[model samples]
Every structure is written in C-alpha cells, then in structure tokens.
Target: MSNQKIYQYLMAFGHFCSDINQTALTALLPFLIAIHHYDYTTAAMLVLVANMVSSVVQPLFGHLADKFNWVWIVPVGLLLAGGGIAATGYTSDFWQLCLAVMISGIGIAMFHPQAAKLVNLASGLHNRGTALSIFAFGGSTGAAMGPILITASIALFGVQGTLTFLLIELLACLMIGRYYRALTELNGGSIKAKQANAQATQQDQWGAFSVLCVVMFGRSIIYYGLNTFLALYWINVLGTTETVGNTMLSIYYTIGAICTLFGGKLADKFGARNVLKCGFAVLFPSIALLAMTGNELFASALLLPMGAAIHIVYSPTVVLGQQYLPNRIGFASGITLGLAISIGGITAPILGKIADIYGLTTALYSVALVPLVGAFLLAKPKD
Candidate 1:
C-alpha cells in the first residue's frame, strides 16, 4: 500500500484537474460573449447549466460513494470535466455550448464528495481540518490556472485553443486510474485510519447542517458573483478591456489559491468555527467596501480581501459540516462542497437579469450584501 501522503497528494492532483476544467468555462465566457455576441443572461445561463446540474446530482454521487466502492469517480470525472471544455472550442451554437458545459458540471459533481470522504478518513480527527484544507488547495490552484490557460490558448489560437489543455487532464486521469487502489487504501490501510473511521459517531445533526447550508449558500453567492461578474465589472463599470479584465480575474484566482492553504492551517489552529466567524466578519465589510470603489486599480486590489474572506471558510465549513453530521460524511461534503456552491451558481442568472435591467453597479452592490445575510448563522459553535 502507498503511504497516506501519496494518496492525499494524488487526490489533490485530481481536484486540480477537475477544477481547472470547471473554471476554464468561467474564464472562457468573455470570449464566448465577444465572439458569439451572447447577452449577460445567456452567458450566465451557461454557468447555471454547468453548475446547477452538478449541484442537483452531487448528493446522489455522494450517497453512492458512501454505500459502495465508487472510486472510479476520480479519474472519470477529470476526463468529463476537461472533455467538456475541450469540446467547448469546437461548437458555436448556444444550445450545444450549454450541453458541453453541463457535461463538465456533471464531471465536477462526480468528484468532490467522494474525494472529500477519502480525505476525512485519511487524516484522522486531530488533523482532519488541515487535511481537507490541503485537499481544497488543489481545487483552488486549478481555479487559479483555468483563466490563464484558457485565455492564453485563445490569445494564440482563437476559441479552439482550449483543446490544447485536454492533454493535461488526460495525463492526470490515467495516472489516477492506474493507482486506483491507492485511493481505496486511504480508508483502510492503517490501523489508525480504521480507528479514525470507526470513531466517527453516527449521530446526525440535520438541523445544524441545514443552517450551515444556508450560510454556505450565501458564501457561494459572493464567490459566484466574483467569478461570473468581476470581468464584466472591469469592462462595463471600470472601462477596462477584456484582456485587462481577465488579467485581474487571474490575479483574483491566484491570490484565492494561496489563501486556501493558510485558511486550512488557520482552521486547524484556531478551530473551524472561530476561523469561519472571523472570515465572515471580514467578508461582510470588505465586499461592501469593494462595491463603493471606482478606480480600476483599487477595484481590482479590493479583490484580495474579498478572496481571503471568502476562501477562509472553504475548508472550515466543510469540516464543520462533517462535525455536525459525523455519520454522514459524504452527505455533509455534498452539501458543503457541492450543493451550497451549486445554489450560488444557480443564482447567477438572477443576478445577470439584475445586471441586464438595473445596471452593473447595482448588481455588484447587491451581491456584496449576500455575506451579511449569513453572518448571524455562524454565531453558533461550528462543531
């Protein structure tokens, strides 16, 4: 059997590949609009297709992972995700584009809960928060790379440039597939690991988890808001070119990626609940202040605090959800990592409609207030 560290890193690698594809779609939206002449609502619907489908189905995948040996999800999901983006460059039809993105979303849905369950079992209780954070870092890194890869590809080869990235995901899939047993070993190889899984009490706390889901849904709104609208805000509100807009986005993603690492470590040291509270405390004000900025440089710089505040809870909330439902790790992960995020993704269209009707500044400020709605929910203990 391979060491737990190998399995941990391997899972993180798969996460990287999975999210790189997921965010690549987001990164490509400007190109899609510029080239195809799509409206904000149409473009936003593409995201809704990619993320909502995954959001709705992820719990099923999680339940399957909990009930059976479904480790195949890791590699297969990577291929589906990257494959969808690769396919994106080949089509121009709106409906066809939606199909491709939805497929990619399905791939994302297949990966997270199962992978998270493995990470939980691998780390044991004492370090589980940090372990999950490390796992989350992989996805954040992929999110960081997605915009750069897709944009560079387009800059060089037009829309078809996204196809070049397929090789990266393909290589990762084969590697993960080849070592499938390593993933299985994560839950059972060591006596301690077995003990850790056993120690997880079966008492499920649905009420607390439901409240946590609402809080997470609010976080997702801010996250999806930035991912979906930040570029457009650069263009429409700040008068930056698409190139500069994407560059700012790339910076936002990269900073968020680095912060995920520290977010995990902080959760381990300060406790997930404390980290979560502090994160939201910072998020509410930072996001509100971001809406009031007008200078392009200052608006872009504002994303740093926004990214830190949003990402700080990425791992902690997942860990806290698990604590709330010790016996339902897969379900908890599904809600924390998948469904709540999807809820936010699904809301993009509504915001897009608002942007269409009311103007971009109003839409931006509206989303900034979403974090404040959930600040009270975290007042209770996370664990």
Candidate 2:
C-alpha cells in the first residue's frame, strides 16, 4: 500500500483500539460493584481516575511526540494498555482494580497524542479537515461498539471474558508496528526532525491560543456531559429501560461518526469555517428540541440529527486550531483533542451535581446553552 493508505489505516486502527475500551472499561466498573459486591463509589471513582489520568497525560506524550521519534511509543502503549485492562478480570480487590486501571490509563495517555499528531502531519491543508474527520469517525465507531461488545461478552462469559477482547487490540498494535515506516513517510517525515522546518513557533501566539483553548474547554464540558450522562438521563428521568437507553447512546455516537465523515469532506469542498458555522447553527435548535421533549421515540430520533450537528464541527475546529498555530500541529492537536477532553472530564462531576440537585432534564436544558456560547466564542477565531 501507499504511504497515505498505510497512514490512514494505522490511524484508524489506533483510534479504534483507544476508544473500544473506554465504554467497556466504565461499564465494567458498574458490573463489578453490582455483581461482585464492591463499593459503588469506589467503582465510580475508578472511572474518574482513569479518565482524568488518560486525558491529562496525553498532552505530555504529544510533547514527547513533537520532540522525539515517538513512533515506537504507540505499539508499546497499546500493549501495556491492553494487558492492564485484561488483567482487571483477575483482580479480586479494589486497590488491585484501581492499579490495573491506572496502568491502562497510562498506556492510553502515551498513545493518543502521538497518534493524533501523526494524523495531523499526514493531512495537508487542502484535505486536513477530511482526514481528521475520518480519524475521529473511526474512534467514534469504536466508542459506539464498546458498550455492545462488552455487554455481550459479559452476558455470555461474565466480565472475565474481557480478556479475550484484548486480542483484537493486540493484533492492531502489531499491525501498527509493522507499518511504522510507511506511517512515518505519510506523517511528513520524523515528527521531531521535520517540525523545525515549519514557520514561527506556536508559543508566539499565547494570547489568541489561550482564548481558543478556553473555547475548547467550554465545548468539552458540554460534549462530555452529553456523552457520559445521556444513558442515565434516559433511564432515570425519561423512564426508559437500560438496554434501550444504551442503544440511544450508541445511535448518538453512530450519527456523530457519520456526520464527522461527511463534515470533513464538506469542509474540504467548501471552507472549514462554513462547515463549522453550519454545524453550530444546526446544533442550537437540536438541543432546544431535545430539552423540550420527553417522548422516548422522539428523544431517540433527536439524537441522530443532534449528534450529527454537534460533532460535524469537531474536525473543522481542530483544523482551525492547527491553522492558528500552524507550526505546532502536534501541540495544537494535543490542546484541542487531549486537554479539551480532559477539561470536559473534570466538569462531569459538576454536571452530575447539578443533575442531582435540579433534575436530569434541567441539567440537559442548561447544557443546551453551553454550545451556543462556544459558537459565539469560536467566531473570534475567524476574525
């Protein structure tokens, strides 16, 4: 295969591996608590620690990717991450489980930044948005697949069967290692060596980049709230069955993936700004409609367009961040992809607290207003 094809395949595989474990890992915690008689709060806390560690540590790896060869980091991280998660099946105590999860999070942290930066490098200005969108779509598909796969595995062989799932990730990692040279060529040569040839450094625009970072931070807060809590809201507030609720979440992610794929192509054909604006414009009414409705079918139907509208903006905005810091594509992807998502993970508890006090409906209603603010803040980037 050509370098570009190999690069795209590696990226898709890496993203798929990173994401498929997320929902499965979290779902495993609840299963442990309910089925194995562990502490609920402890199980929940494991999820928090894993997410926080994964998000915060990704940027450090991104920085390393920028300064070091880092090609070898991806497969190593995947192996460690897969092994850690698989080992969770054998842990009998809470601390053991936490340690296992922390190990997996470390592996995740090591992998994402390097992979994302690699994605950005392989994509040129003309097709950057499309390339990034395809990469993100792969991850979204994996994320959606996680719950279903894990739930099925658990149903058939209990939680211990999760170990078998690790084989998929292991094969992917080996594939990435096998194609390393082609990936390097596709990513515009060695990450550390080639970056010095670019124009001005990213540090030059501290002021504007800071503002953009805040916008990403805000966007993530709303995004994770929806991602993490949607199922709970459906079951607890709207009185849907857990199975039905999970399927809705799956549909949301599936639509998000589909939209991102097209969104990239559109951004390449039109302008990234045009695609971004259109996505946000659609999101406003979608969220409003979601807040006002309670019907199960209606809510499920709303997720399709709502997810599409919300995520279609992702690739374009990521490209915008890189454009703003044209010389520091690695750092830009880290900030937007890694740190922003981390910030969102931090805000999840606050959203949960609000839901506890006010109501899930009210919490979601409030979340609807956040994206509008992001849309407004994002306008200044164009100016």
Candidate 3:
C-alpha cells in the first residue's frame, strides 16, 4: 500500500506494543509472585516501579516531540522494552525481576508520546476524533488481550515460556517500525508546525482543561484498581477459579474497548462534559455490584458496564484535553495518555496495601467512593 498508510499502521502498532507490555506486566505480577515465591508487597512494588518510569519519562518525551523531531525513539524504546520483558523469564531473584521491570517501563516511556505525535500528524481535523478513537482502541485491545496471553503462556510453557511471547511482540514491533520508515521526518523541523497549530487554538480554554484533568484522575484510579486487583479478589474472596476470574477481568476490558468509541461519538454529538458525567454515574452502580455481589453470573453481567463506565470517560476526556491545549498537542497527549494514567499507576501500591490490610471487599468499596470525588471535581459547570 501507500507509504503514509504504512507509517500510520506502524505508529498504531507501536502504541499497541507499548500498551500490551503494560497490561502484560500487570497480569504477570501476581503469577510471578506465585511462581517465584515473591509476596504481594514485592509484586506491588514491581508494578509501581514500572509505572513510575513510564509516568516520569512520558512528559519529557511529550515536550521533546513538541520541540524536536524524535521519530526514532518509538522503535528503539520498543526494542529495549521487549528485551527487558523477555529477560524477566530468565531471572530467578527478586531484585533481578525488579530491574527487568524498570527497564521495560523506561522503554514504554519512550514509545508512547512519539507514536501519538505521529498519529496526530496522520489524522486531519475533521476525522481526528474518529481516528483517535481507533488509536485508543488499540491500547484497550492490548489491555484486553494481556490476561489471556499471559495465562495461555503460563499454561503451555510455564513462566519461562512467557519470555518467548514477549520476544515475538518485540520482533513484530521492529518489523513494523522498519516498514514505516518513510514517515520518519529526518530534520528537526516539526517544531514550527506544532507552534503554528498552537497559535491557532483559543487560549481561554484552560478552565476546560483543568476540569478534564480532575476527571482523568478519577477515572484512572478505578480503571487501574479494577484491572490489577479484580482477579485476585475474585479468586481470594469469591472462591472463583483463576481462569474464571481472569475471564471476568477480560470481559471488563472488552466492554471498555467498545465503549471508548461509543463515548467519543456521544461526546461529539452532545458534549464532553455530559458524556464524562455519565461515565462517572455508571461507576456508582458497577462498583457497588462488584463489591456487594457473590454470585458469579450476576457479577459477570455487571462487569459489562463496570468496564464500560470506567473507560467511557477515556475518549471524551482525551478529546477535551486536546481541545484545552490545542497549541501543545503532544504535551496534552502526554497528560491524558501518560501523566494522569501514571498518577493512577503510582496509587496501585497504596491500593494494594489497603486491600491487604482492610480486606479486598473493603478496599473495593473504598475505590467505589473515588467516582464521587471525581464527580465533585468535574461538577464545575461548563464554561
């Protein structure tokens, strides 16, 4: 096909790989604990360290993407991440595993912002929302596939075999990157284009941006908590099989991926504020259902919207973030895609501690309260 098409595909695939690594690691942590005799504290710390690296580096990369051309960062970062993840299967010690996680995190940190910048360049204004919806869906799909992939690998090759899976993903990324080389701008010249775009946006939109950030903080906490901890709860408290529990988690991510596009369309048709509020509203019932129910069938049904409610805010909030900082699309993307999400990842350990101490049910109930805080923060009437 065309060079431009190849470039967009490569950029999207890069985003896909970055997301899969994050989700795969989250899925692998508890299993790693089981196989290696590491405790919950260590598992929590591993996730925290990985996420911390991504959170800290993404904003810097965002800034670089705005000021300079850094197209090569995406592929190099993916290769590093792939190598780190593959090596995790070889390490037997706790510290070695942590180092591997740290390496993977650094790789992901480099990939996301640069790849997102490329997607923004590929999509035009009229179709930006739709294009971004597809782009975001790639990440969501990775999140959805992670648990299944990890479980399958563990079943077939045991823990060590998981490394082969990671290696394959990395090789896929390398091939995609090489094939899309035409999209790589050789000169550091995109700064002027970015600047000109920024100049065209209305500067008075900061109020909208601030409100959106608060909403993001709220959505992220619930999403990460559910993604990381729900399987543990299902197995520990509810007495479900590990496979059943993972399937439930998978269902949640699937609904989340679907609703991201729906939420974006709803926002485009109505408004981001209203769509965002509705997303928060969905959380109250979904979280309550998850916390209070013991029935497997009931919990599975409720998980449909539980996932949807948690992620429906994603697309709208993303669009709002871009609108708020039209001049700095890359920076805005880092905030929505990386920084705010990192804030959520950083909190995963604290959430794990709470679950460990207070009981999983109580910890979940406490998380259910997060949307209220988000709602309060977002309740500032539209400007």
Number of the top TM-score candidate = 1
Tens digits of lDDT, candidate 3, 1-383? 75444555666566666677777777786678678776555677778887788788878888887787667777778876766777778878878888998888888777777776666666555455666666777778777877787778778987776676467566766676565445565223242366455446556367767777777877778777787788877888889878877777777788888877787677667766677888788897789778998887787788887888877777667666776776666777887887777667777888878877887787788789888865444433222
Q: Given candidate 1, what's the lDDT at residue 70?
A: 75
- TM-score versus the correct structure, for each prediction: 0.95, 0.87, 0.90
Descending-TM-score candidate ranking: 1, 3, 2
Q: What's the lDDT for residue 100 in model 3? A: 90
Question: How high is the lDDT of residue 44 in model 2?
Answer: 48
In the range 1-383, model 1's lDDT, one tens digit per residue, is 44566667778888888888767887888889888998999999999999889998998888887777678887777778888888899998999899999888888889898888888777756788788888988989898888888989988998888887678878988877776776666544343555645646456778778888888889888888888988888888888888888788888888888888888888888878788778888876776766788887777778898888888789999888888877777878887889888778898999999999998777888897887766455444433
Location of the lowest summed lDDT over 10 successive residues in candidate 3: 183-192
As a TM-score, model 2 comes out at 0.87
Tens digits of per-residue lDDT, candidate 2, 177-286, equal 78787666545465434544554443445566676677677667667667666777677768986666666777787888788788778877876667766776676677
The collision pairs in model 3 are 198-327
TM-score winner between candidates 2 and 3: 3
Structure candidate 2, residue pairs in collision? none
